[model samples]
Target: MGRKLALLIATYAYEDEGLRQLTAPGHDAVALAEVLRDPDIAGFEVTILVNEPLHRVGAVLGEFFHDCRHDDLTLLYFTGHGLKDDEGRLHLATADTRRTNLAFTSLSAEQIDRAMSGCMSRQQVLILDCCYSGAFPAGWLAKGDADVHTLERFQGRGRTVLTASDATQYSFEGDHVSGSAARSVFTRHLVHGLREGTADLDDDGNITLDELYVYVHDKVVDEMPQQRPKRQDNVEGRIVIARNVNWAPPVHLGEEPTARASAPEQMPLLQVTPLSVPTPVPLVAGRMRWVFRTGGCVRSVPAVVDGVVYVGSDDGALYAIDATTGEERWRRMLNAEGVVRSTPIVNGAVVFTTADRSLYAVDARTGALRWERLLGSQTTLTVGIVGSLVYVGASNGVYAYNAEDGQERWRNVGQGMTSYQWMVLTERLVIVGNTGSHVYGLPQADSGKTWATRIPHRSVSGPSALSDDMSLLYVGNSRGELRCVGTSDGERLGEHGVTGKAIYSAPTYVSGSTESPGTIYVGNDDGHLYALEDFSYERKWRFVTGAPVRTSPAVDDATVYFGSDDGIVYGVDVTTGLERWRFSSGGPVRSSPTVMHGLVYVGSDDKGLYALQATY
Candidate 1:
């Protein structure tokens, strides 16, 4: 078995009276030590020193590190006060560290570095939860953010460092939500990250050092906007810091997960798939590391373009989050009008969405309002952008507006077909349907309907999908039937029924790649997600979740991902229909999952939008 050892140093009862007395360091150390020593979390050999003498700090650290074996993992954690000496060197102040003679009394960063240099352990992690902790890197100060490649460049040396504050920022003492003598802001969240599932960004049950840093950094900064944590890594492999109690190591969702294992080596971040046309490309699965949050429920799937995540909230705001750090870039709000339930679409430099019965176009980078147009009524429908036109379906009608300005281009005000699911765009036509009495095909250049078909007893449930040859269009209906019709004419091709229950949304069409055969997936109120052979409508698999799955399904290379009203997101094998994993949200999940790059973005009625990493 590999050795896992950690030394915790917390000095709140400093001998020097001139320094401010602190209440958190002592408590923070005890709390975190308990979490780390738990068999379920870190299960480390924890040696805690609280208010120890200045002379003893150096000897103890050396004794701890010097005994580490080549394959052992060693961690050193400190909390108290951090200072910069006259020489601008970083020091961790001890209980007896006097301000006047700090150089002779305090332990320096170089001293720890020296002990670490001689250690045989291949993995070492340092966490400094004091002011100016970011200065722990002796020669690495004053450098701005490192590029993505920095982690790879430092791979050979498995030293990972995280600090509570940047060199210029202060480590905060958080508000006592309940009692006094509360933990320090950084350590409180740090403990929360280690002990709670909040820090498990991927829902994979294990929290990596990098993932913990992101979760803690965002939370600390959120509570105190002035403080920013910093992290530097030379880790060649993932350094898992803790395990979540609710999750086991990921296995197929219904199968037994393997015991938590060491962090695996990773490749670099996924780059954006370049846009050759204005449609989505099939996504390849990868690990996800972070999630972004908004003020209210996010019923819409997120739009990722360039490097930003454009998403809407029922709080009446359209937000842009940094795809890398999950930091808010900017926000454009609708000001108490209504919720923005429709997913946003990113095209060129602008992003568009529907809210409060109007269509809004905002600058993608700056979040400045580019233009706004009021439809007849408030809408939960998403707007479509093709070429230079913006199409919106509302209570009054389906209206087309010029994308350059808010000018109304055309309106087919009485077709009675409206839904927010999806709209199939073709080279020369736009086909859209809804849970109304009809489905319509209209010219891209005008609002004139090319063809309209009315169902005698059934209503279209969602949007439509065009066939590979662009000859047939596929749509679902509340009648529980999957219907296919000729795209050029109004001729009915075929229709198939499923459990005699109403289909809730649009069907997804997967074109057979060299690796997969074409398949179609649709969900119904019967609580089943039916997978059918493309063109043939032959049933392939029907997965059952006791609760209805009104949400649409998104796909990665090997899995079909969707959410259930039961508040869980399920990843199932596309071929075998075996569950791969399930992530629980706080409330019902009605919004569809959006798979992009290496993440799954979805929303819950619990007022949270989640970003989950792919797990096999």
Candidate 2:
């Protein structure tokens, strides 16, 4: 029933020569204050102190906690340099703090503990984003279990504490270069979750303290593997921290929004349109809807279902983002050993492969892991899901698992597969491209019964698409040979040669309805996207790009969209192969485009997931 209060302290301009000047504390404080003070969000009465002297900070810190009542919710956040004294006691450095005389010049953990102990608030939360901030409770009591004893330091009945790192680690500063905005890696995610409402893990319009800690913890570790954020809780009940501004009422895909929902932005962004290429009707790229930033490069192809877009990143986590706002909903850590380069497949569950040579199945709604299976060391390709079965190709062989339980159905060994082999799933067969200029079609009923077809070229590096009748399969090899093989048998029907050095982009086949001849769209390492006639393998037109077009093109009614290694996503006319519009990202884009509704979604190596919409 009482008001919410917050005291945010940041000290970066240290006077002592031994103390290192930090660039993120001031920026972190300002961002946190804005989110906490917003009436629609946290609605906290905030008192922020930036670069204050030790004496002034101590006085304000004491008075801030002293004014709280038993029913009030009090939050204390500090971002600065946390130092240790000769006795291994923790001290918070301030603007005028000296390293030589820490006991008198800096604020000690004991002093803050004393002020917190005297405060009447039972709902108290302490967040420390600093080097060695985890030593606060241990340094104060020097007693029992670290977590339990830390909770006892504060005299309040229910209190929670979150630190940027454990006692032995240092908090990291991120993107603090000459021209970029300075930000602490830990606090940056904190503000992002609160402001974007991503910390609302349940999507119930409320963000709790525990949810905030978990969101920040995963994001921090993904960016800085050396730093592990810590959280110790002794709260009796959930403490609601903020209201989710981005929360939208649950509306299933294809269903109209309820009266409570206002517009497209208030609804979950879900893709209903299928992805095709080289259709009769062409579409053009309009304006950029939004771009979502992650901690690392985003090379994983995104899967859109309902209103959430699921994608993996080099940051070692799978993120589910809202399609409309480009704000994250939830992120789950898959593996620490390797980055996620495989595109995610979302069925009833989400399936993806990490660089660690493992396949993971997680719940679609909450991102909770359902099951995981270890594969061959080279198993890192995107998985294919058909019905209740999931298929993948590894260096050793092809493997199949039950999509629901992750149970191994079969493994056909001795066939050589590569990381780039794009497994093409059909009604009766799982067609896979290999590294040795060979393609295999393993029968769905029996993976052991496989048919191999040899291409008179180098390795097959991309995916294969079926003809409109599903009787012919077309695959491209590293030697720039487009080979068409009969689906029933592995006999090569025909081949078309190109001038490109290689072709890593998967070929997409569009039927063009019953009126037009089928067209095939593919990209080449020679920096061009080619549109070819399906049966005759005749080149209709070729569109040139600045760099290699490594991404497969996604086609809708009027346009074919794809990304180039030059860091640009281009929309081209499907019929003429003429350029329509282009959007540039910060880094190279290897992720394929996904088109649905009136929007196009793709990822870039620049750590961005972009959503571009067509102007009506």
Clashes of 1: 4
User: How does each model score on lDDT?
Assistant: 0.71, 0.76
Give the per-residue lDDT digits (tens) of candidate 2, residues 363-468: 9989999999988657737688888888887766778899989898887776655433567777888877666777777887665655788876765556667876
lDDT of 2: 0.76
Per-residue lDDT of model 1, residues 345-390, tens digit only: 7775454555667788888889888888777764537577788887
**Cα-based RMSD of candidate 1:** 20.5
* TM-score for candidate 1: 0.52
By TM-score, the best candidate is 2
Q: Give candidate 1's whole-model lDDT.
A: 0.71
**Candidate 2 Cα outliers beyond 4 Å, as residue runs:** 1-286, 416-420, 513-515
Which residue pairs collide, candidate 2?
A: 269-307, 276-555, 281-557, 281-558, 282-558, 283-558, 283-559
